[model samples]
Target: MRALFCYFSATGNTKKCIDLYQNYLSLSGVESDIHNIDDGKLEFNPEDYDMVFFAYPIHGFNAPENVLKFAKTLKKCKEKKRLIILKTSGEHLRINNISSYSLIRILKRRNYYLTNEYHYIMPYDIIFRHTDLMAYNMYEALKGLVPLDVKDILDNKIVKLKYMPFGHLLQIFMLIEHPGAKINGLFMHTNKNCISCGLCEKACPTKNIEIDEKGKVHFKHSCLMCTRCAFYCPKDAIVFGLFNSWKVNGKYSFQMPKEEEVDKHKRYCKNSYNRYFKIAEERIKNQK
Candidate 1:
């Protein structure tokens, strides 16, 4: 049976899990094709594959907007088998299901079967700002146990011993409302350090950041709080106030070298050149 692994990743944590899964599948002799959602539009015949894997990071307690759109599009297909949703979240796995549950309800209404749902934990996003190294280590250990054929592991009594208590606590925490009132609206701004590198816009999964007519970076309320922009920023210009304090504390900071910095004035023009040139090359090769 063939499988299709479709995924969206921002900080590469989800990609890391996908890589591990792909490696396990290969060792188990499973035939699969992996695709990055950014590479191109997915146009596949579901009849050609026996299983489909939707892997994505949970953002703002929801699946990234792009992944949600992909799921909606696939719902129109007549494939009968349930799709596997492998999600990675900054929170514990139990709370992670909050978003997956919403997506599953949508797909089910469209006649798609909901197969097994799995959640893995990763470092918190810049918005949520959590840093528990112990939790991260436990998450890694659990991931190592998920074999290509996970039924056996699922049936084992020891599974509960490993993940139950923490999972239950996460679920309980998900039910509690934040004491602080939610912000109705906000905007992100870049400081002078912004090299105008455009990496923030490119890394944003929701496409919420854009260059305005005056050539200044602007953000919308659609941000998932994933902090891909702040974390990946070459110049460390993007700021989100208290939401990004963990980064300020150096937990999520990713230092880039001076040589890697892009010119502030040439950001958009250079990005456009690279994007179109790559597209042209792909078109030419496909025509052959």
Candidate 2:
């Protein structure tokens, strides 16, 4: 059977999981097409695939806008397409994590059947660094989930690991209380170490970062809180915290590679550039 895997990821954890999951599909003899949720409508016809695997990170209480937009594209289709949502979150979503309720509702409205679903606890992709051992264990646990998910999907069984209204309630609380989505970029600043490299500006999905011709960095909002700009900054120049400039610890950056960081970036950059940053550029270009 033919399948499509469409995903949106900022810090690479979701992408890494998809990469590993692809092998499982291959072993099961399922033909699969993998695409990032970007660039308007995907090239393939939705009806052509037997099933669609929608993979993405759980941003706060919801899916990323890009992923939602992709789903929106298929809203009016009359085809009865099956869907499997593979969500990656940083421990908040132990299983399907009730936050998916909203997404499932949206898809249901669009008339798509969710045949299977699962979630993986990816390494902490935000905030402070995770301890090395903790990172390893989390990675291992997430990796282990991949095989089970693959088998379940191949068996045509629906898997719901957890279901509770409390998770949905937590989403509401986080939405009201978590300032990360509202003002994350507001506190970001470019320290003296920044080489005026435009990498962070390019990495951000939200176009919240602007680097002028002279390399002066500017932070403005509608931040996704994906922390791409902060972690991908080569110089550790972009920091998010109250009074960021005064922090004695200096700006924090992700030096810890998840295995050949530079190599993985090289392989994944072009795809991500096409997937996320290009959309941001187009939005700005259109605004002008």
Candidate 3:
């Protein structure tokens, strides 16, 4: 069978799992194509593929806005199309059972069948989120889940799914998390260590980072809070905190491409690239 594998990966973990899943598909002799959703060149008719495998990182216990938008983009797809969701997270327990529910709701809107779902406990790179040793242990534990997941998908099995706690609570939490996730970017500030290399600007999936005429980088409110900027900043200059405090910053290392090489995996976006920028702009304006 043919498949379309689309994913949004802040760090390489989700993409890494996607690659292995695709490799498994290849070994099974199934045909498939892959796309990075934020490439900003969204195009696909899920009706054309026998199955669609969507993978992404769980941000703040919910699917990123882009993923929701992608679901809307597939509105015209035929009904009963097979869909499988794969998420990668650091704390799978807190990935929020509602996260999967949110995705199921998205699929239901389009009348797509949720055939199977899975999540991987990949290494968490957020510095304050987890330590290097914890990440190593998590990676070691989660990596083994992939091979079996691949076999289940290939065999068209009704795979069991895992959910996080507090269904109603997480559903309500989403409302709060929505604004909190976006506003988190407002807390992102660059330090004196920033060389203005524009690394953070290019690495953003939402095009939330912009360089003004002063050649200084600004973080807009379109952020996904995936920590790509904090993880990729060359000098560790991107600091995110609460109440202007940096002590709680997460420190995790993620391999990043050079600024010029970012386009190979992601698209460069600015405030205008996001639909809520006007509101985000107003918020930023009022904050100052």
lDDT per residue (tens digit) for residues 45-82 in model 3: 67878888888887666787788777666664655888
Tens digit per residue, CA lDDT, model 1, 206-245: 6778976675788876665556677777777876644644
**TM-score (all chains, Cα) for each model:** 0.66, 0.76, 0.78
Better of 2 and 3 by lDDT: 3
Q: Give residue 79's lDDT in candidate 1 (0 to 100).
A: 49
The predicted structure with the larger TM-score, 2 or 3, is 3
Candidate lDDT (C-alpha), each: 0.58, 0.66, 0.68
TM-score of 2: 0.76
Candidate 1 displacement at residue 124 in angstroms: 1.2
User: Model 3 clash pairs?
Assistant: 97-164, 125-252, 127-250, 127-251, 127-252, 128-250, 128-251, 207-269
Better of 1 and 2 by lDDT: 2
